[model samples]
Each structure stands twice: as C-alpha cells, then as structure tokens.
Target chain A: MLQIMEGSHAVAEAVKLSRPQVVSAYPITPQTHIVERLAEIVADGELDADYICVESEFSALSSCLGASAAGSRVYSATTSQGLAFMAEVVFNVAGMRLPIVMTIANRSLGAPLSIWNDQQDSLFLRDSGWMQLYAEDAQEAMDLHFIAYKAAENHEVLLPAFVCFDGFILTHTFEPVDIPKQEEIDAYLPAFNPYQRLDAKDPISFGMYATPDYYQEFRYEINAAMTRAKKVLREAGAEFGEMFGRDYSGLVEEYRLDDADTAIVAMGSVCGTIKDAVDEMRDDGKKVGLLKLRSFRPFPYEDVRTALAGVSNVAVLEKNINIGSRMLGAVGLEVKDAVYKNGTPVYSYVGGLGGRDIRRKDVKMITEWAETGRNDCFFGLREEVL
Target chain B: MGIFLRELRIHGRGGQGSVTAAELIATAAFKSKIYSQAFPAFGVERRGAPVQAFVRFDDKKVRLRSQIYEPDYIIVQDSTLIGDVNVFGGMKKGGIAIINTEKEIEGVPDGVKLVKIDATSIALEILGLPIENTTLMGAFAAATGEIEIHALEESLRERFPGSLGDKNVAAAKKAYEIVKGGL
Candidate 1:
C-alpha cells in the first residue's frame, strides 16, 4: 500500500517483511531508525525474531555471524566506524559464505567526526567480498533489501550483501512509498533454506583455517561467486519486478542518455537531484543526462560502457574521494577505466562529502566543465574554509 | 498542479519537534493528494540549539533530495532564533512566513507576508507544554491554504493518540481558527 514514511522506517518495514530469525545491532551514534523499528517489531511480537543488543558493532556482526553459522537466516546493519570496527568479521562472513543481508545507512568515517551522508563508508569495504547495492530513494532502498537477500542466498552467489542508502539524506527523509504486502514479499523471497548449515546432528567446521595453498583458492571461489552474482541479482531483480511492477534488473539505469553529449554517472540519493538537474538542463538545450549505478560491486563495466557508448564526455559526480588517487572519486576511477576504450574523458567531480548540499546549478557547472576541457578536480572547495 | 513547486523551511531549536512538524505537514499534504517530502538539516540536536527542517510540495513526485536553500514559505518555531540564524534568508517574494510569536519580528524579508501567532501560548494552554509544532502547523495551513485543516488534523491525531492527541488537535485547530479569522 502507498503510505508516507521516514526512509529508515521504510527500510525497517521492508526488513520486517524479510522475516529474519535474528536481528542484531548496536545502538550508538548513527544507530539508525531501522534498528530501532526492527527492535520494536520484535518486542511487540509483530515479527517472530530474537533482537540481540550488543556492546559494539564488532559484537553486532560477530553475533550475526554466529547465528547465521548455526543455521538461521540472520540480519544486521551498521555504518562508518561501526562497519570499520566489524571489518574482520565483514570479510569472515563472506569467507564463511554467510548470506547475511545488512543495510548500510552510508555515512563518512571520522578523524574529524561527521554524522552525515557519504558513500565513503561502503566504498571502504569494497574489497570485503560483500556484494554492494546502492539505492537512490527510500522506495528503492526498501525494495533492494529483498533483492539483496534473494541474490546473496542464491546457490551460485552465496555471499553477504550491503544494501546502502545515504545516511541522513535517505534515512531520515519522509516520502511516499508503496510498501509490498507481506504475502507478496513472502512469495518473492521464500523461507531461508540454507545451502550449507551447521547443526548438532551434523557438526561442521566452517571457515576452517586454510594454509596459503587453500587460501588462494578461497579468494578465487569468492571472486567467482561475486562474478556470478551479476546474473543472480538480475534474475532476483527481474523476479522482483514481475511481482512488484518495479524493475531492478538492469545493473545501471540510463536516464535520458540516448544521444546525450554529456553524462553524469553517480549512485545513491544524489541521483534523484541529478535527474532534476538533467531535466532543467535539457530544457535549456543541453544534451545531458544521468547514468545511475545501482550495483557498485561486481562492477558492471560492460553495462557502464554500453550505457555511455557515445557521450561527448562524462562527469563522474560521487560523494567519496580516493585520498590521493590520480582520479579522486572512488567510482570515477573505475568509470574512467570503463570508458577508456572509447577515448571518453571522465572528469572526477567529487563533492557532497560530509553533507555538503549539491544544488542544481552545480550540476550545470560540472556539465560545462566536462564540455570545456576543464581539468578534473574536486568540483567545489571553500577557499575560506581551507 | 495546484502547487507546481513549493518549498518550506522550518526553523526551531533542537529537541523542539521542527523535524516532526515538517513531517506532519508533508503527511498532511500527502493525505490531500499532493506529493510532499520532508527532511532536516540537523546540527548536533542538543536542546536550545538552532536547527532547520524543510518540506517540498509539488503536483508531481518530489524527488529532489538536496536541502532547501530557497523556500517559498518559512515557518519559525521560535522568534528568538532569528538572531541565531537567518530564518527568512532565502524566502521568495510573495511567499509567506508563519512565525510562532506574540509580537511582530524585525527585518521581515522583502515582499514576504508574515503571519504571527502566539503558538507557544496556545500549545501551553491546551497541551501544557511549550511545544508549538502542532500549533504552527495549524497557522501554516491557515496562512498558506496549501493543506486542508482537516487533513492536518488527521495526521496530528494519528501521530499523537488519546487525550494528548486530542489536545494537540485542539491546539492546532485553535491556532487555525485564529489565523483563519485574522485573514
């Protein structure tokens, strides 16, 4: 049914429909409303589940790892430092092949503390063997959880997944969303029938210590699983659309890219604003559009290349910087490589870090920069702030 | 497209339900068959600290996710925060400012109509608290006419139930009546 709700609550409502047996989390700064609502759902007997309150994000995922290892469809959520704190287990969950679905309300990490929206947190775990999916709005954020669980648990794609939406930007906003019915979700995502399980009757040691000889193969198998997930996600996404009328089958969504002279490739909530900017620019006779990336991991290079086949140039507007990489933004680096063969110049326009608002004018300015052969740099910098 | 595109910026102290007021306004607008979205520009969230929340109402889906820098309407939950922040900084001409105050504020933005109400007193009278979010929502509905009073009432009642909810509805309705009569 269509209803108005906070983005976090929307994800929570969807998570409730996922019906995991164990929902574990640590309530701290950035303790998103998703966890609170999930706890309430469990406490009120609305969802039959065990809500584990842990001391740290470390314990949070560790508990999820244990619960999943012991044969229960489990869930967890974290961001920024919490995800960093649980780093060891983040890799272990995938290495052990636990198909746990974790929602990441993406926030920036801190030496200078920030409780704001950014993609840096999720990007930090890019190599953690977890399949990463980014959503542009609350509705997409809510729907992707089901898709995450479906794909992660696929026999060929037995891997953990992070369903990421911008922290405060997407998490706290209120908007209209068509929440799927419980029965509809149930039909889409069946009960968790584990492909591998640990039971008292059949004791099994998962994540057994592999010497260097076996360790290399473990990495290969995990990479193979990540590679296979592209298809699994498409199947899961197509199945979701068949049932829900919203398609997520395409790895990258092309928004008015056909015959476009310039393209802005981006992910997460910022894509919505980019679409609005693109509309306004098109009105002004600018041949511009957006290529929104839905899947960052198992990087869809082929899809991205196809999407931007003939763009004059591309402005890769992202929320995270790669410290000192030649191409600054994390997503742009790969985007540069994808379009390298086409001789398309991909300008890295990294802005919106730590919650700096990216208005419509900035989008137009970046488009001009891409067209004029302006040097690629961090698009916006406050001279006084420096 | 009754309202083609209307943006609202709400200013209040932290812990004063500014974000809640924006949400209820959005919910009320949604109930009226309008597409609305709301979010906050939170700053630490400590009580008595200045904070801003925003709402956008449009005939089509409201998909712009950036914070509102320019607004067509302004709602000031506290008059004192005027010195702390520019409550009417980017208000468009011919826009309206619904403020919770008993006296007229200085430096009302050029060409913007100001609607002043003693929302705190109204809230304290009915709910026995200084929280004027519900009252201001009433004043906002009356001043702007972008949302129907009854639709606002429905959201208020649903958000806050029982006698507390009834009292909030009463406070909002009273403010609504005052603003409506003044207009």
Candidate 2:
C-alpha cells in the first residue's frame, strides 16, 4: 500500500524489511532521522536486529564490520563529517570483503561548517571499493537499499555498498512510497548466507598483515569482485524489478535522450529538476535530454557510453567540485573518460554545493552552455559563466 | 507521469507547524491518489523565526526537488509575515491565498483571490492551543479542492491518534465548514 512518509523513514522501513541482524550507527544531521527511525524500530521490537549505540562513526562501522565477519548481516548509516570520520574503517570493511550495507545521506564536508546537501562526503571515498548507488528520489532511495543488500551480499560479489541519497533533498522530503510486506521482501531477498565467517572451529584472521608477496593480489582480487558486482547488481536489480515492478535494469536511466543534440548528465535529486527543465526545453524545440546515473562507483562506464553515444554534446552537472584541475568533478571526469572516444565534447558544470538549489532554469541554461561547447560553466551563478 | 501539477507554499514562524502543514496537506493529497510531495527550506529554525514549506500535487510522481518559486496557491499561517516575508511573491495570478487573520487585507493582485480566515481563533477554540496548521489544512482543502475534507481528516487522525486526533479533526471540520459556507 502507498503511504506518505519521509525518505529517511522509507529507508528505515526498507532496512527493517531487509532484516539486518545488526545495525550500528552514529547520528548526524540529514542522516539523523534514518538512524533515529531504525533505533525506534529496534527499540519497539518491530525488528529483531541488535542496535549498537556507538560513540562515533568510526566505532559504528567498526562494530558493523565485526558483526558482518561473525556471519551476521549488518547495516549502518552516516553523512558528511561522520563519514569522514569513518574513512579508515570504510576501506577496511571493503578490504576485508565484508558485505555490509550502509546509507549515505550525502552532505557537504565542512571547514565552512555546513550541515547541507552535497555529494562531497560520499565522493571522497570514491576509491574505497564500495559500490555507490545514487538515488533520484525517496522511492528510488528506499528501493536502492533492497538492491544494495542483494547485490552486496552476493557471494560472487562480496562487497559493501552505499545507498546514497541527497542529504536534505531526499532525506527530509515527504512523498508517497510503497513498502513491501516483510514476507514479500523475504521472498525476494532470502536470509543472508555467508560465504565465510568468524567461526571459532575454523579460525582464520581477517585483514591480517599481508606481506609484499601477497598484498598486491588481494587488491587484484578485490578489483575482480568489484567488476563482478556490476553484473551482480543487474541480476539483483532485475530480480527486484520482477518482484516489485520498478525495473532497475539500467545503470543509467535515460530521459528523452534519443536523437538529442545535448545530454545533461546528473546524479541524485537534482536530476528531477533537470527532467522538468528538459521537458520544457523539448517543447521549445531544444534537443536537450537527461542521463540520470543510478550507480556511480562501478562508474557505469559502458552504460553511460551507450546512452550518450548519439548526442552531439554532453554536460555533466554535479554537486561536488573537482579542485586543482577543471577536467571536471569526480563524475564528470569518469563520464568524459567513458564517452571521450566518441569525439563528443563533454562540458562540466559544478553547482549546488552546500545545499545550494539547482532550479529548472539552471538546467536549461546548462544545456545551452553544453551546446555551445562552453568551458568552466558554473551553474546557479551565470555571471561566472558569462 | 501525470501532466496536471499544482504547487502550494506555506509561510509561518518556527514551531508553528509550517512544515507539518505542508506534510499533512501532501499526505492528504496522496491519499486521494494524487502524486504529492512536500519539503521545507533547510534552515536552522528557531521559534518565531519565519520559515517556509512547500507542497506539490501532480498527476505523475513529483520529481522537482527545488523550492517552489511559482506556487498556484499559498497559506500564510501568520499574518505578521505578509510584509516581513514576501508571502505573496511568485504566486501565480488567479491563484488563491488563505491567510490566517481577521483584519481586511488589501492590494491583492488582479486575478488573485484572497480568503482571510481567523484560523488561530478557530484552532484555539477547538484544539485549546494556538497551533493552526490543522485548521489551515481544512481551509486549504475547501479553498483549492486539491484534496477532499475526508482525506484531510483521515491524514489528521492517522498522524495524531486518539483524542488529539479527534480535536484536530474537529478543528479542521469547523474551519472547513466555515470556508465552504463563505464560498
């Protein structure tokens, strides 16, 4: 049944349905409501999961890591500074090959001290070997969790995943979402069956010191598993679609991209405004379209290439800035790498930093900038662009 | 996605249910099988500080995440916000505004309709507190017809169970009847 609820609550409901054996998290703004709701679920006996109260994000993920190693499905969530604090454990969780799932309520890192929406914090951990899934709305955000656990826990792809949604934009927004019955979710995603565990009978150390002779191969094996995750997610997502009806078959969801002159590529909730803008631009005979990235860490290189192949030019609109070099933001850099062989000019426009709004008109203007092959296009501040 | 889209903006001071009003209204619309979304400005709100929240009812899933700039309707829960904040700003002509006040307001733009109701008095009488979002929600239903009175009542009851829900439903119904009778 469709119920109107906050995005955080939807995620909590999804986590509950997934029936994680353990949940350890420290609360931060935007990410607070999610962990808070999960706490309520656990405390009220609605869910049987053990809720560990940790002092900081580091301890949160550390204990989740420990729980996963003990053959228990674990979950956690954090954002911004909290995520930054968990940086060491994040890589360790991936390196140990624990298939823990976490929610990232994407927020801006602070020296400027902002509790606002941005992709900076999550993107900072881009190289950490975790699958990052970006959500476009509350429904997508909640749905991604189900897929994340399914994909992450796959034995062929024992990798952790980040189900990321824009901080306040999705986390705090109220919208209608359908939460499946627990039994139905159980039917779709069965109980976690570990490939390996911390069995005292068969003792083996995890993340033990690997000498120079063996350390490099662990990295290679992790790479192989990460590569395998791409297929794993497609299979898991297709299975989810078969059960839920909303297909996540594609890594990138195309909107009016066929025969388009320019494509506006984006992630997270801003893509919604881009679609609204693209619709208007289409009415005005502008061949503008949107390529919404659903998964960012596996990078969706092939899917992005196929989607943007025919477009005359491409514009990557992102919330995080790539400092030092203007090659692009993290997303733009990866996208340009994917489609550059097609000889299509890809321009990067970074805006919406620290919760700055990306409006529909700004999307239209970015499309115009891309069509003209403009460089260093700063959105929401057209004066800089001019 | 559905083609019909309507936007509503709510203006009130902090701790006054501006966000609650937006959410309840959206919930009411969604229960009516209309796609609905509601969000508040990301602000560190303190009591009595002006704040804004918005709602959209669309035929298709509402995807736009930006703040509503051109609202089809508006609800001002505090009359003091009329000039302090541009409560009327960016409201489309032919739009309706439900302002909670007793004083006659003038200079409403041409093609715009303004309905001034003393929602605070109504809320105080029924709810025994000065919280007016439930009362304004009823007025919004009667004024815009975006949601039915029954839908709003159900959302109110679901959100506030037991006697609190009953009092809120009573406040909403009284306000709804008053607005419907006025029209």
Candidate 3:
C-alpha cells in the first residue's frame, strides 16, 4: 500500500524489513530521524533488533563493525561531521570486509558549522573501499537500503556499502512511497550469510595486523572485491527492479540522453531537479539530457563514458567542491577523468552548498554555459559576496 | 478540476503547526487519491521564529525535490508573519491566499484571491489552544477546492486520535463553514 511518509521514516521501514540484527548510530541532523525512528521501532517491538545508543559517531560505526564481525547483520547512519568523526573506523570496517550497510544523509562539513545538505562528507571518503550508491529520491533511498544489504552480504562481494541521500532535501521531504512487503523483500534479499565471521567454535582471527609482506596483497584483494562489486551492484539493482517496479538497471541511469548534444550529470536529490530542467529545456528545443550517476564508488567509469559518449558537451553539477584543487567538484573530477579520453568537454559546475537552493533555472543556465565551452566554475556564486 | 499539479506554501511560527498543516493537507490529498507531498524548510529556528512548509499535489507522483519556488496557493497561519517575512513572495498570479487573521489584511497583491478566517479564535473555541494549522487547512479546502473537507476531517482524526481528534475535526469543520459562508 502506498502511504505518505518522510524519507527518513521510509528508510527506517526499509531497514526494518531487511531484518538487521544490530543497529548502532549516534544522533545527527537529518540522520537523527532515521535512527530515532529505528529506535522507536525496536523499542515498540516492531523490529527485533538491538538499538545501541552509542556516545559518538565513531563508536556507532565501531560497534557496528564489532557486531558485523561477530556474525550479526548490522546497520548505522551518520552525516557530515559525524561521518568525519567516523573516518578511521569507516575505512577499518571495509578493510575488515564487514557487510555493514550505512545510510549517509549527505551533509556539508563544518568550519562555519552548517547543518545543511552537501556531498562533501561521503565524497571525502570515496577511497574508503566501500561501495557508494547515491539515491535520487525517497523511493530510491529506501530501495537502495535493500539493494545495499543484498550486495554487501553477497558471499563473493563481502563489502560494506553507503546508501547516500541528500540531507534535508530527500531526508525531510515527505512523499507517497510504496513500502515493499516483508515477504517480498525477503524474497529479493535473502538472510544475512557472512562469508567469514568470528565464531567461538571456529575461532578465526579477524582484522589481524598486516605486515609489509601481506598488507599490499590485502589492499589488492579489497580493490579486487570492489571491482567485482560493480557486477554485484548491477545484478542486485536488476533483481530489485524485478521484485519492485522501479528499474535501476544501469549503474548510471540516463534520462533523455539519447540524441542530445549536451547533458548534465549529477547525483542524489539534485538529479530530480535536473530532470525537471531537462524536460523544460527539451520543450524549448534545447537538445539537453541528464545522467543520474547512481553509483559513485567502484566509480562506474565505463558506464559513465558510454552514457556521455554521444553528447559533445557535458556539465557536471555536483554539491561537493574539492577545495585546494584544480578539479572543481569531486564528482566532476571523476567525470572529467572518465570521459577525458572520449574528447567530450566535461565542464564542472559546483552549486547547492550548505543547503543552497539549486533551482531549475540554475540547471538550465549551467547547461547553456557548458554549451558555450565554459569550463570549471561555481554556479550561482554571489559576485558581491566574494 | 483540470489542474495537473498544485503547490502550496504555508507560513507560520515554529510552534504554530505550519509543518503539521502541510503534512495534513498532503495527507488529505492522498486520501482523495491525488499523489501529494509535504515538507518543511529544514531550519534551526526555535519556537515563535518564522518558518515555512510546503506541499505539492498532482495526478501522478511528485518527483521535484526542490523547495516550492512558486506556489499556486499560500496559507498564512499567523497574520503577524506578514511583515516579518515576504509571505506572498513567489506566489503565482491569480493564486489563492488563505490567511488566519481576525482583521482584514492589507497590501495583498492584486489578481490573487484572498480568504480570511479567525482560525485562532476557532482553535481556542474547539482545541483550547492557538494551533491554527488544522483550522487554516480547513479554510484552504473550502476556499481553493483543492481538497475535500471530509478528507481533511479524516486526516485530522488520524493525526489526533480520540478526543483531541474530535475537537480538531470540529474546529476544522467550523472553519470550513466560516470560509464557505464568507465566499
């Protein structure tokens, strides 16, 4: 049944359906609702799980790692500063190959202390060896949780995953979502079966110190598993599409890209706005399109290239800026590298920082600017403020 | 009746239930078989500070995740917020403005339909509190015809169960009658 619910509640519902044995997360804006709802569900006996109220984000993820290693399916959520706090444990979880699914309500890192939306936090951890999947809306965010757990717990791909949704934009927004039934979700995503876990009878060592001789090979295996996860993600997405009506067939979803001369590539909630702008631009006879980059990590390089192969000019609209670098935005830098050999001029436009509104007009203007060969620059920058 | 999409912006203080109003309206729309959404501008302001919430209704799912830049209707839960914020900003031409004011409002832009109701008084009489969110939602349904009063009543009952739901539904009904009579 379709019910009107907040994005956070939808994610909580999905997580409950996934039947995670242990959920540990500290409260943070946007992400707080998700954990709070989970806590309530656990307290009310709706979801049979341990809701650990950890002191800090670091402990939240660390506890999840410990639980996952102990052969329990675990989950956690965090945002900007919280994620930054958990950075060390974040890489450790993936290095240990624990299949913990975390929901990253993407928010901007603070120095100015902003509790607003941005992709800075998760993108900062792009090299953390976790499979990163960005959600475009509440439905996708909810669906990605199921898909993330399924892909993460796969015996061949025993890697953690981050299901990222824009803070406040997708997290706070209420929408009519068709929450999948428990049996159906069970049919799609089987019970957690860890490839390697700590058990009293087996008594296997986990996360043992790696010396110089074995460290490089361990890292190589992680990279190899990440490379294998690309196919796992595609298959999980296809299976999810088969179970649910939403099709996430490709790692990068193309919208109106065919027969277009120019296109905009974006991730998370902004893709929804870009799609709207693309529709309006098409109405005005502008041959524009959108490529919603769903999977950011395992970087989907080949799929991105194929999606943008036909377009002459591509505008990369991202929320996170790579400060202290010539490469403007994190996603933009990756897109430029992905299509550089194709000779398609990929212009980077960073906007929607600190919850700044990226309206339809801004998307249209950015696309037009890219058409004129305008390279890397921030969109909607207040000239006077500078 | 031929409307494909309708957007509404609600203006109120932090404790005035503006966000609840947006959710209730969206719920009512959904109850009426219209795809709808509701959300508040995620701000860190405290009670009595000005805040805004938005709702969207369409024949199909609402995919636009951006804030409602231009709304077909504006619901002002607190009349005093008119001077503090541009309550009418980005309102579409010939749109409807449903306000909870005891006195006649001034400086409303021309070509926009206005509906005024003493929702605070209605809430005081019915809910025993100055929560005008549901009251204005009632006026909105009666004035704009975007949602049915019955649907709003059902949403109220669902949101506030038992006696509280009964009182809110009564307040909503009275406010609906007041707006209907005024028009």
Candidate 4:
C-alpha cells in the first residue's frame, strides 16, 4: 500500500509486520515516533505484541533481552544519548545472541546537548558484534527492518542487528512509501525459530560466567557468527529482492559506475543526492558514479575493493569523522582498508555534520575534486572565516 | 496537470508554519492531480527560529532530484528570513516573491515581481496566533494566480479534518483576498 508516512512511522510499520512478540521502548529524540506508533498499535490491538514501557533505555534493551531469551521475537529503538545509556546492555544483547532488532536513529552524542543527526552514537557501538545496516530513505528504513530480523535469526548467524537511519532527515521527512502487503512479508520471513530457548523443560544455562579458558572461544564464536552473517545478509537481501523487488546488498551499492574514472562514495541519504549529481554529470560527459555503503559491519571489504577496481580515484564522504587521525575518515576504516593493499587511491570527505543539509552541487564538487586526483580537505565548511 | 512541477521556497520562523505551509501547498497541489513533494530545512532553532522548506509539484512524474536551487516562486511567512538568508537567491526571472511584512520591499533583484501582504496580521486576527503558513500561501496564490483560492480551500479540506480544517481554509481565503485587494 502507498502511504504518506514519516520515516520513524514507516519503520514502526515494518516492525509491526515483522511480528515481533515483544516491543520494548524508551523515549528518545528522533526515535520517539517509532516507539510512539508501536505503542499505539499494541494499544489498539492492531498488533499482538507486549509493548513494554521501560524505565530507561537500559531497561528497554534489557526487557528485549529477557523476551528474546525466553524465545520471543524482540524489537526496540533508541537514538544518540539513549544508545549511549544502553551501551552495556547492547553488548550483552549481542553476547547472548538474542537476535533482537533495534533501530538507532543516528544522532550526535554531546556535552553541548544536541538533538540533531550524526553517526557518532551508532559508530561508537560498531564493535559490539551486531550487524549494522544503514538505510538511505524512509522506504529503505521500512524494508531493512525485516531484513534485519531475518538475517539476525538465521541459525548460522544468531546475532543482533542495528538499522541506523539519519536522525530527522529520513525520520522527519514525509515520503511516499510503498508498504509491502502482510502476505508478502510473511512469504519472505518465516516464524522465529530460535536456536536455543530458555524453557524450563530444557533448562539450559545462559549468561553464565565463563573463565579465561572458555571466554575466548565465546568471543571467537561471536566473531565467526558475524562473518557468517555477511553471507546471510546477502542471501536474505537477494531473497527480499526476489519477493518485493527491492535490492539491499551488504557493504556497498553501485550507482552508474560503469566505465567511470571517478566514484563518489557515501552512505544513507547523501546517496540520493549523489545519484542525481551522477546523472547530470554523466550527461555532461563526466565519468562519475556512486558507491553507497549499506552494511557497515563485517565491512564488505572484498566487495568494496571489487567495485572500485577500475576507478583511479574514489571520494569517500563520511558524515561522521574519526577526528585527530586522518581527516574525513570513518571510524570503521574498512573503506580505506579495502584499497590499502589493492593499490587504489581513495579520498575521504566529511560533510553535512550536525544536521547540515548536503546539496547536490556539494556532492558534484566532491566528485570534481576526486576526478582531478588532487587531495585537500573539503569539509563543506559551513562558515567563511574573515 | 494539477501538479505544477513547482519549486517553492518558503521563509518563516520555527513555529510560524513555514514548513507546514509548504506542505499544505504541496498537498493542495497533489489533490488537484499534481504529484507533490515537500521537505523542510530544520535546525535546532526553537519556537522562534528562522526556518525554511522546499516544495515541488508537477503534472508529470517528477524525476528532477536537485534541491530547489532556483525556485520558480518564493513565499515569506515571517519576512524577517529575507535579510537573514538571501531569501531571493536564485529566484527565476519573473518569479513571484510574496512577503508577510507590512513594509514594502525595496531593491529586490531585477526582473522579479514582488507581492507584500500583512498575512501575520490576518492570521493573528483569524487564528488568534501568528502562524502565517496558510495565510501566506493564500497570499502566494493571489499574487501569482498560480492556484485558485477555491482549489486551496479544497486542498485544506483534503489535508486537514474537522474545525481546524475549516479555520485553515478561511485563513487561506482571507489571505487571498488581502493579496487580491493589495495587488
């Protein structure tokens, strides 16, 4: 069904159809609407789920953990400060392999107390062993949640997943979204079959303290499951595309990259503008394409390398920065690492920080700078210094 | 084509309905069989923060992906954003610029037609608040004649519900009359 929906509302709708058995929430900026809608759905009997109003973000994830451990499909959402508050619980959720799906409306964590968009909140938790998927638009935000649930629950990849969408950019923007029918979603996703459930009949010990001898293996298993998840993500995305006609490749997506000497790399909403820039620049006979990073974790290193094999220059536009080290660098460092040994030149750019609007022309300028194969800092500096 | 493929830039304060006004115009246009798109440029500006939104409407399937760098028309709900952020930047030649301030705009860019209306006064009188979004849009229609006042009212009915819808329609109608009288 086609509907004019807010980004967070669309995400909530997708979560509803995914049929999470437990919906736990703590109100936070940018992510409030999603929980608000989910609460309404549960309240109105539109959805048959336990909508738990938790005391804090910590409890929100903890409640989800408790539900998932008891073999219930779980869903939750949080933003910058909320995610920070729940950081310890986030690792525990992943460590327990509970397969909880969370939507982190990306925002800047701050001492100055900003409620705007920034990737700092989520990026900081990238190493927590959860599969991270970044959504480019409202429609993608809606669709990826299903993908997250499917991928996370796969027995080979019994892990949690985080779908990050820009705060207020997609969350607040009103977009025309093609909501998939419930039957189609059902066809794509099967019922949750948790690998291990905490039933009294089975009586399996969970979250038990492990000594140094076994602790390493448990950590190793988490690492291995993440690698397996990369393949699972691709398969689930392919299956989803076959069913609903929307393609989501983990790591990266190429837009008009054929025979192009220059490639502009970005993630999330900036890709929308970059595609427009690429189309116009191609018409003007500039050989430019775009690479959109979708899956941030398990950082599709090989795919990133393969996509940019022929291009002489690649410009990476990072919304969040790894300040103090390389300028305009992503904390993951996988994009840079992709070309490190392969011998390709990739320029990094940090633009549109703190909710600054990134325009098409700015993307075009970044493309131009990369095409010249010249390197200098281009931060899309918002103010002019006298 | 009811969708005008229009790119309108609206200027107002945070609580003044600049974004909402842009949405209403797009909604009204879409109701008239136009494919409409609307987006607001939001910051941390609180209740009285300067804000803006861009709207596009077209009869055909709109594929142009660029933000409205060169708006075909401009609406100023607060009028104060005009000086703060070059509100007239990249306005098309012969484009309509509508402002809600009582003072006349002088030294505007050449080849641009300007229309000034006291929409804030009208909104304060009618809605008892200075949310000049519908009123400014009404002034927008009257000055540009891009849309009929009746079409806007019909759009309000489609976009809003109950007495709130009726108030918005009345505000839009009154705004149109102000523009019609002033112009």
Q: What are the lDDT figures for the candidates, one per model?
A: 0.91, 0.91, 0.90, 0.81
| lDDT (10s digit) by residue, model 3, range A169-215 | 98888888889999998899877988878899989988899999899
Model 3 pairs whose backbones collide: none
Tens-place lDDT digits, model 2, residues A31-132: 999999999999999999999998999999999999999999999999999999999999999999999999999999998999999999999999998999
| Tens digit per residue, CA lDDT, model 1, A183-267 | 9999999998888798999889999999987899999999999999999998899999999999999989999899899999999
Q: After superposition, how far is residue A291 of candidate 4 from its true place, in Å?
A: 0.8
Which whole-number lDDT from 0 to 100 does residue A140 have in model 3? 92
What is the iRMSD in Å for candidate 2?
1.6
User: Which candidate number has the best lDDT?
Assistant: 2
Cα lDDT for residue B73, candidate 1: 95
Candidate 2 chain A minimal-lDDT segment of 10 residues: A376-385
Which pairs of residues clash in candidate 4, taking residues 3 or more apart in a chain or in different chains? B3-B34, B3-B58, B5-B57, B5-B58
Q: After superposition, how far is residue A206 of candidate 2 from its true place, in Å?
A: 0.5
Q: Per-prediction TM-score, please?
A: 0.98, 0.98, 0.98, 0.89
lDDT of candidate 1 vs native? 0.91
Docking class of 1: medium
CA error at residue A360 for candidate 2, angstroms: 0.6
Candidate 2 Cα deviation (angstroms), residue A26: 0.6
